[model samples]
Target: MPGARRLLWLIPLALVVTGGLAAGATFLGADRIESDLTARTRDALVAAELPSATVAFDGRDASIGNVPADQRGRARSVVLGVAGVRTAEVTGQPAEQAPEAGGHVKRDLQVRLDQLLAAEPITFQPDTAELTVQGTRSVSRVADMLTAAPANVTFEVGGHVARVPGGDPEGARTLSEERARVVANKLVEAGIAEDRVRAVGYGDTRPRSESGTTDLDRRVEITVR
Candidate 1:
């Protein structure tokens, strides 16, 4: 009788151990699946040249981030095409636009442009309208971004120069204008339509610094039109 009781107790203990092992195996398998999905999705985005986009997964659903408004559809499609992704949601995008929302879209593009230039300002050779190597690269990136923008959107390339003691205002204006033209031409060469861009020179009238002229004053700025 005592042996029968002992056997019953051992049977329940064995079952409990087996159940715990199964639960652990299931959890580990789930983790591995999520990891594989993340890597594959990232590789797919990079292959599509949307490396700036980020992704995260919850089960089979994916959340994609940092995708530009114009590229949202493409990013979502790319993610959804992944083998394990059941659904994809693009985050951080502007809402569906109404006809009256044109201004908002323009503003959003302007902010993006500003952030790009802030990180990588377009530079030129000393006192010449020629672009440096870095400046050329920056222009190329700008071109790519603008190429993705809406067709109705336009841009203004504004150039400004620093003020110096007894500097020739006329000369400054001419230099600034030439710089603007050079940048505009580079944009056109890179793929932007000429009709969509306008170049203007502000000369020393728009110094970025209130106290004195700095290197920043001799710079170029882009505005959405």
Candidate 2:
């Protein structure tokens, strides 16, 4: 009778061991299958046997376009032949406007202009807020960006000053503020709304760059709102 009772106990233990082994086998089989499929897909992509083409994806669908004038047919064949990829819908017109669509118009315009916020140090006429030629160009570009923005756009003019050899911090702050106001006035003259602009100055508070000491200390930036 004791042996029969021990046999009953062993039955449950055996069931538990068999269940664990089944679960482990299932997991390993799934992993191997997934790994094999991934390898095949990667190899197929590298082979370029499917239709190869430049296609544009618009969330739901991909549309292929003229394949560089010379490789259109081959591109279509290659891209389409890929194992899992859906056939691409081809189009005649441009898929989407590129950054270079307008002859790089925006970039050209920005290049001709100057960054209102710069690390380069700019000095005004001695003791006055008058901007030199380079400063004027920078200020003009800022004005243009502001005015060209939507009519309801607002901006803040931030001025920074370099640490002068003998100047006091307090005076520098005041001067920087004055310079900021001067820039604001120029923007107004260039057709920006005066009511939408405010000015603030940081005197020797923010350095231009981490490495340099004096190359880029004084500057200005226009924050768009």
Best by lDDT: 1
Q: Which segments of candidate 1 are over 4 A away from where they belong?
A: 1-101, 210-212
Off by over 4 Å in 2: 1-127, 210-215
- Kindly list the per-residue Cα lDDT of model 2 for residues 1-225, writing each as its tens digit: 999999999999999999999999988876665455444433433344222223543322345664445545655565456554455555685323222224354444444333434432344554456776777776765665555554445667777676767778888788778888988888766656567789988876777666323435556666655
**Model 1 lDDT, full chain set:** 0.82
Per-model TM-score on C-alpha atoms: 0.53, 0.44
Summed backbone clashes in each candidate are: 0, 11
Worst lDDT 10-window in candidate 2: 94-103
Candidate 1: count of backbone clashes, pairs at least 3 residues apart or interchain: 0
Best by TM-score: 1
